[model samples]
Target: MTNSKVGHRIEELTTPAFLLDLVKVKSNCQGMLETCKAMGVSLRAQTKTHKTVEGAVLQTGGSRKGIVTSTIDECEFYADHGFDDILYGYPLIAHHMPRISALTRRLEKFHVMVDSKLAVETLIASQPPTGKTWSVFLKVDCGNNRAGVWWEDEESIILAHQLGSYSSLITFRGLYVHCGNSYYAKTDVEVEKVRDENIERLLNFVDRVKERGVTCETIGIGSTPSCKKPSDNMKKLDELHPGNYVFLDVQQSTLGSCIVDEIACRVATRIIGHYPKRNQMLIDCGFTGLTKQGEGMLVTGYGIIRDNPNLKICNMTQEIGYIEPLKGKLDFEKYPVGSLLFIFPWHSCATAAMHSVYYVIEEDKVVAEWKPTRGW
Candidate 1:
């Protein structure tokens, strides 16, 4: 049944609405889940990309568990929805401990990540209620250099030992790393290469920690690009967490992680004006709608027009997106004022974050509305 509240047809919805293709979303989830199963790893579906209970349910295949969130709000949102096992995959903030402690008391298993002594110390300082010990993972910087202690650094081992020493307040769960560098790779081979290198470094870190007599229970690693086209060499890793695979964007497509057809989310907008002499068309979608993210290899524009990839969103203001022809001339009559268009975002995660709700579409009809948990 079509969701009457949001409108049945995509065109009927208000301009600058986020759209999620139900079929594509399910396929992406199933494909990644199968990939993890084949690689002998568990899929800890990252909810950071689509911070909605419905999307998380689909990503987890109705298990309503094994999730990785970027914020405490997401953790609380999912936990309230009966998602018991969750890993807050960000460096622990001392100020957020009160809420974290409250969540830990209720959840069956709520884990957090720490890359420094301060984070570990903070976790130790903030003790949960009785019978509650925080499950924690050491964020190891495999190669991305974004967060986490470097894999080769002895500090990781030191921190593991420190976390272990405070066994009553914290449990040193395992190691976690994000291969963010894979997003910069221009080809599938390079993406797989990054994945292999990241896994190798992660395993090396695990071994070094084990040599010190500490048993790392869960070795979690993944980025959407790496997991979508994982290297066959991935073995021994206990879990995989890839967020963007839920709704691949132009960036993933350009990186060869997923084909253009696999992009599941887009901004549905309407043409507001046309400038024939300037060869540009104005749309109601803007930075707040499509986001200003683009691929490293091609500076196509803010987003790719779903029907006409040649039309680039060259510039955008708060609510106005300027679409100009990247190649050849623009036909004004083809996209007159009020004409609706679907624009596949450059980065689905950022683009989706701009909207509060997604008009869930299946067979070109709105079947449901997914409300995302927003804010820090």
Candidate 2:
């Protein structure tokens, strides 16, 4: 079941190994499940962070049902593996209709999100499998302008009305929002502010849709920062989808989603060389292992070295990372060559994308290996 034989000791494994702490993953997943439960909403956990089947199972608390994906391939991958109620939570394009049709016919509840008029028209023109209809969720902006139609814009209502009009071909499920702006908040209060604001906007938009005579069967919002610390207003929504909480990163910690200890995934690298002359060291990890998404945002550099505040990953090449002391000169003796060091990534989704296989570890022993599905 492993892609390759994993060694007993973590230190024995190859450097730059993607390590997933199974215990923390379970705890994090449980915490999110409890959060959604307390909020009185369904948790349609997103699988874009750790696209492994095992992670999805844990996110769903073994139900293997209620899940959303960032790509169509993930939708198919999950469907092929017996998961249902899958939503291709991306802005739909015409080219992907063939596969979408296949998934719609295969799964009991395969949904798609749309934010544009072209997407609505495309879905209307494309007939679903015999006796089947395309389940659609209108993506609303709700202050996160990344994708979704703007909540204040008239087009948002127009699109929803159009989707609902074609009842024979498209079943307008409801509204969906990303609420990604919560990450921009520096304090927990600020994060809550963003979350509450988005909720207010979303609910208002739902009211407008209802005014247009379109009934929203479900209303959902996602983003680890907001979903982790859900407010009372979230109870009004029907679903919450947060993916990065399963393997929280330093960014999530800063956003008050989880503490640094709750981060379940890390890049296990080793000190390969020490350069006292330049007060720096080199590790066998680079942009290829841990992405540079955290660049300039963290004082600890690309990633936070676990339990080593003095160390900072300053720079990275293709296969090597530059580490330097955060304050004073480097004490090379303390960190000997070949010694193990784990780096908590700033963005787990980006870091996870860099590795094909993740070593699932428990108490420093490799218990399993998780291979994620790749490609857009």
Candidate 3:
């Protein structure tokens, strides 16, 4: 039934094709499932990384099928596809109220994160579907100090109380935090240290809210680097909300979140230009195919040329990759003009965001054509 579709995907495949290994992708999905189930924690895998119904279906294990989305566009895409529980992971922004309100109606259980008084106050002002209860989670900043509120902050505890007061305006589901700082840890021991600090900080807040007689729903934490090592500390929270696990990339692999074998997606490109004199080759894949964003300390190239790890395709313009040799000088003879090459991106999110569609590859052949729901 899908042979022609696969064939079409291969034929129309131009330069910089997104190649997804179905087997690896599914394995990564089930691994996340096992980690969540074993921890006795609710696993709501974030779908923003792979904003497609096909991707969501793979993550639905043991009837717990909820997924997290960073943008309202993803929520809408998945909702129409019949995905019920959608958590917009980002703090609800000011101008996006209309969509949030509309999406709430479409979803069976729609939740958004909030931390600042301004955001909470704005959400209240938006008056999104008063008849329909909109769930909210307080964003806790354990250590990363990004969008979340400090766990012990009096202002945060007070807002939780205020939001809980209005049953009509909002349903205070729980407090959520993302241990984003774990990415900086050089070792598992260091990551575990961050984990303990994060959990302790969040638990302290839970204790404070409970003292105020405020009913707390769930305690949540996310981030691929932190939750990737579930045995270390992810289960400490009631739920884990790691997204990049869907399509593990170079960044996650280096962090030990995933193995090189677990990387589910890659960019397929053809060698076009070879500068034998300068010891540089060029692939049709460029910054558009890869990401401008690189990984930590190591000069994480735009993306990795997986076939040859030693040879880094370091520099990239819009349409070309300045490929260099890992060993000796000129090796244009090794790679023919039409040879297909695979590239592992610096970050999965960046690569996924730019591409319109991804081709599921199996046994070195194209299989399923999955279209990502892009924007916001």
Best by TM-score: 2
Which candidate would rank higher by TM-score, 2 or 3?
2
TM-scores of the candidates in the order shown: 0.96, 0.98, 0.93
- Candidate 1 lDDT tens digits, 1-376: 8445454777678889999999999999899988988888999999989899988898888999899999999999898889989988889888888888888889889988898989887887776789978999989887898999988878778888787777788888888989999987878889888899998898888888887888888997889988887656676789898999999988898888889899999889999998888989899988888777773334557777877867877888999999888888998888889989988888899999999888999877888899999977
Model 2 scores a C-alpha lDDT of 0.92
What residue runs in model 2 are displaced by over 4 Å at the alpha carbon?
1-3
Between candidates 2 and 3, the lDDT winner: 2
* Reference-based lDDT, each prediction: 0.86, 0.92, 0.80
Which stretch of 10 consecutive residues in model 3 shows the poorest summed lDDT?
Answer: 2-11
Candidate 2 positional error at 322, Å: 0.7
Pairs in clash, predicted candidate 3: none
Rank list by TM-score: 2, 1, 3
Candidate 3 stretches with Cα past 4 Å from truth are 1-5, 8-12, 62-64, 126-130, 232-236, 295-300
RMSD (Cα, Å) of candidate 2?
1.3
TM-score winner between candidates 1 and 3: 1
